[model samples]
Target: MTTSWWTFGLQTVNFLILVWLLSHFFWRPVAAVIERRRQMARDLLDQAQADRDAAAQALEEARRRSAGFEEEREKILAEAWREASEARSAALVQAEAEIATLREQSRTAIAQEEEEAARVWTARAGELALTVAARLAARLDGAAVTETFLRWLTDKIAALPADVRSTLGAAGEVEIVSAAPLEPGLQRRVGAEIGAALGASLSFSYRIEPDLIAGLELRTPHLSVRNSWRADLTQILAEINHDERI
Candidate 1:
């Protein structure tokens, strides 16, 4: 078919108009919408990345803060424990100091009491010595004082001291014991009794007091009894004188 020139021209014009219409109206608006959507997606992705970074930073900061809090709590607990221990130690020291003070006070009191007692005892002893010396001066001297006093002393000693008189018998024996002219039986009797009482054996001496008018005299360290006629006669004469006076 032979195409007409005018139809071809019209068809070309229509094709051109369609392309222009698509480019200007449909393609331009569609491309603009697609670009806008792409931009929005990119911005959302950037925001998500920023949020993730912020979360990671916050988490690290929270962990550091938690660790610092734990360390502080432990330090506080340790300080409290140390303070309690110091308080206990101070209390114990005070208690020991009080005990030491009490002990010293008690020791001082006891020492003072003992010293005072010793002083009192010393004064009493001095007074007793003076009294004993005065009595001794009266009885232990003077002449015939020896012979006559010895005679009197011997008889009185046979009766024992007033303190021990009750233990002695009414018929106490008298022996004039002698190492010389000494009889064995005399030694045995005197030694046994005196040994039992005093836990020691007795000693003897020989004596012939030419002054003794008759019977012998018995003697021990602390005792001497005169069993003599002279002693008896003197006593009898005194008794007769007493009867005459009555």
Candidate 2:
């Protein structure tokens, strides 16, 4: 309150010096430290940003890889399903083909068996019929029957192959009925009868039978005929059957 002007000026100058010294020494260093700290903090923030960006990028890559794997899995599954379906179809087709082949084979085999059986039956029936006819014919006998039978038998025998006809035994030798002898009439001229019937040289043998109801049965290698009552009845019945057929 009692200060001079010079004292006031001096005090102002001193205050200015103090402010300058404080700024140069203590405050300036502190500001620099603060600025340095702020720069370091900024650098740390940049590094953290970069790390976060890298992490995000890695996550994206991992997502992409997962997507690729998933796509592959889906593709593989689809392919597998397709293959399985194809395989199933192929198996079904194969099975059907095999079944068809087997069925055809079975049909063929059955047809073959049937044909063979028919052939065997036909052969057996033919043989049995011939044998039965031979046995039946042996019992027949008669003069008129013998003449008719000789005519028919001669014609049939002439139709046979020469080799078979040549082997024929004498007509009289073949016994129709064992109990009776060959008729003396046929026995006397058997050679001439055979020669006339065969149109060639001939031989003969004698046989007799009574079972034919009075008739004669003649047989050659290639021909047989019963000239007897039994044959007469059979012929009549056959004629009746033929009339019925007509």
lDDT of 1 by residue, 80-144 (tens): 89998898899889888888988888888887676556545444543343344334423543233
Compared with the true structure, all predictions reach lDDT values of 0.56, 0.66
Please provide, for model 2 over 160-220, each residue's C-alpha lDDT reduced to its tens digit, 9 standing for 90 to 100: 6776555554333442332245566666554466566556555455565444444455565
Off by over 4 Å in 1: 1-6, 98-246
Which pairs clash inside model 1? none
The number of the candidate with the highest TM-score is 2
Candidate with the greatest lDDT versus the true structure: 2
Error of 2 at 192 (Å): 3.9
Q: Which stretches of candidate 2 lie over 4 Å from their true place?
A: 1-55, 127-150, 157-191, 201-246
Looking at model 2, report the run of 10 residues with the lowest lDDT sum.
170-179
